[model samples]
Target: MECRFPSVPGAERILSDEALAFVAALHSRFGERRRALLAERDRRQARFDAGERPDFPTDHPGLSDPEWRIASVPDDLKDRRVEITGPAERKMMINAFNSGARVFMADIEDALSPTAENIIRAQINLYDAARRTISYRDPATGKDYALGDKIAVLKVRPRGWHLDEAHLVIDGERVAGAFVDFGLHAFHNAQALIDAGSGPYFYLPKLQHHEEARLWADVFAFTEEWLGLAPGTIKATVLIETLPGAFHAEAILYELRQNIVGLNCGRWDYIFSYIKTHRKDPGAVLPDRAAVTMTVPFMRAYALHVIKVCHRRGAHAIGGMAAQIPVKGDPAANEEAFAKVRADKEREAGDGHDGTWVAHPALVPVAKEVFDRLMPAPNQVDRQREDVVVTQADLLTPCDGPKTMAGVRMNVNVGIGYLAAWLSGRGAVPLHNLMEDAATAEISRTQLWQWRATGTRLDSGETVDAALIDAAFHAEVEALREALGEEAFAVGHYGAAADLMRELVQADELADFLTSVAYERHFAD
Candidate 1:
């Protein structure tokens, strides 16, 4: 494929003669670099594949053993009356620790300014805060001295690709590390956290491809060897925000399977991605200032995809942030906001999401309440039927009907795509019907696996075989083509999904007809 750069104002254009010469020279240099990188990667992968004594740290020394457990908040805290931090912006970290969240991510990537010096200072303060007890005043009462311990905190640094001169400071000192981008940085940060007597865990952001995820695992292995951390000690929660990442959700999850602890839907970034991906005609895409509602169908699909992916992996599928609440406000307004937050939490819980994040400390109580009500306690398994049950009281209940054989087919096809992508080591692929968009193979496979295990009843069913799945997938693709037209299958500019499907088919690693069906479904346009 020819590389076409996006047209930016004032961008320089090369003359034909200069461009040809430059291309030749660039190719020669790039070929050598690529060869060396690939050779090194292979050498490292060999050691990893052989399960040789890893050079980096693993849970081998019991570093992953929890040294401290934060106290659980009371049910009343769910009323959203608790306040963790002061009103100042800097207080966000302190507030989160006090707000009763099980995990507090000191975000240096997205939430904070992308300046390296500021990031280092923030990290140092956060580290200092984590090691000591802090006090805050009670907002409700005129009381002073409400003591609180630091919660489980994790620091997220900018990815190597995005890091400028600003991301070099760690504890006021320059730390030499490759800034590969979010996926790689996550593993690197996990290693750093583990080395610093903290847990090996992180919240990864801006992930767009399944290959990126596999690369993360590779980097994690490298970090483990470098730092002497245990394998499987570092866990990550990937933020599903961008259009590419959304479609590739299943692939990413599958690649990072055991290492992933949670999956989060990033609503804002996703909205931006959707605008960029779908609005082919620049004029049709809305302006940056447009106010689009978050409740659109695409957003819902993205959210549902995240939830499905996490559930399949038995990992936590965390809901998006509710940043609408005020940090401090009128009592009545605050009460109303808290009430609304409570309702939102109830809805998410009903939808099967394990937990959610809140930007304000004041919102934590309400958030936690919703999670507690929805989540089965660690000790409380099998309290309900194994089927996908939805009481009338549940907010998002499955429609009542005899299971549609067509729906079953769709699920089965989705499963084949999942298995094929996994076998081929792809993160995501286009769905059978939607050539313009893609779904994570992991998500499709998980849904199929769940459906088969649970049965086709409105509430639950049992698992189907690979044969059934393959048949269903092909059928769905055909049905979709008939509905959306052949052109719908044409992903004019999107190559990741098509390329991945092609690789899977060419390799024939999956079931015989699986790749063929996917290719026709995704590329027949």
Candidate 2:
């Protein structure tokens, strides 16, 4: 109903009267319930703080029907052997669609820093992308870019329900960011995609509970009704990335059964959630971020169980990300990165995952090669993992490894670097040859907080306290300054990022998400 900054040019096209009306209708209908669900998160968190552990819903009716299955998926969505994810920036969009993957998920969430300009720009690109009219040229290099005849299927990821778009005010309240991203695109591009023999496809991120999934289902149903489309026109794959959300996989699939197609194992955020959900439990302190691989007891259990539950319910069980980016001009380093990605993708393929994600375009073929060689079919949904049985305790199994000073240094360095880039208008950034997004940075921040709060003892007998944290931060900052010259470091947002990181890691309680605090403090319209 209102714009926070009306003077921002190009706002008119995205915020046209009809678009605003649709978004406002969505907000007016579901805004209060969205707020209630968010409050439910705090309530559930309070229980976790009070020593109540999360468990699967025992009374869910959907589990009673062993024959129940989600509606059949679209033909294009089947055979998603390799999927690529990136922010909806112009160049990234063009490249990702042409990345030779089955699906290119244009993420407007963690992979994107939610600036007003960025959100509007993403929506505009999605409009063009749906119609295959998207194009670009290198202003500096004089090179041209356009969509090829064959491109990866476009699936958009809107911001999670926990976020709001400060730039778009509707009915005197800041509209949900999810509504803006989903509403604008679905409003503008759904019919075009339908006409093209495709429909509005989406990847829902950061759902901590099945109720959240239920809310999304309601949103999708309402959108279809609003747009005069058939039921189940919108298809989504939920990312079972949170510790709590993983426990409710059956219920989540049940809630979105009408429009649901698959479930993805999100590694980074699930680890982060494991730390945050158990932040108050001293025994749950994890090891170095790198040490906690998908093979860990809990992660392994969840990954296998996802395959079991998804296949049982006739949905595709997508695997986690291969975040390793290819390095140029250094054959050895590039080989090492390639090896890591290959191993990860192979494990996913062998474990009966339908597909896996790659952060960069170059790694698409690398992932595809693994799936293509091993799978030899469109999908393996028939491989019911009945032999794989994971229990409540198994899903919550504690990680085991050594906590060291090196781990602390890496966390501090990566956290600051990511925050600096996120504040500088980039959501997905390259750090140490890997693509770092909000989810990865979350692992850094939450791990640091858990260590400090529990006074974790490092390999060198050093206790994780405020002093040790400050020391690590300072050491990493100086190292970064030398690595990236003083002039560049001084001009960047590293200073503000440092100040914010200190406040976050030093807080008495762990924050839910670093982006939440950062967006409100700095990037808010």
Task: Give lDDT: candidate 2, residue 79.
Answer: 90
Q: Rate the local accuracy (lDDT) of all candidates.
A: 0.44, 0.91
For residues 363-458, what per-residue lDDT tens digits would candidate 1 score against the true structure? 777777666666655311122223442221221111222444555554444544444342332322334322111222323333343333333232
Per-residue alpha-carbon lDDT of candidate 2 for residues 288-327, written as tens digits (9 for 90 to 100): 9989999899899999989999999999999999888889
Which stretch of 10 consecutive residues in model 1 shows the poorest summed lDDT?
80-89
Q: Cα lDDT for residue 207, model 2?
A: 92
* Alpha-carbon deviation at 93 in model 2, angstroms: 0.8
**Candidate topping lDDT:** 2
The parts of candidate 2 lying over 4 Å away from their true place are 5-10
- TM-score computed on alpha carbons, candidate 1: 0.49
In each prediction, how many residue pairs overlap at the backbone (N, C-alpha, C within less than 3 A)?
A: 34, 0
- Let me know the TM-score candidate 2 reaches against the reference structure: 0.98
RMSD of each: 17.8, 1.1
Residue 444 shift from truth in candidate 2, angstroms: 0.7
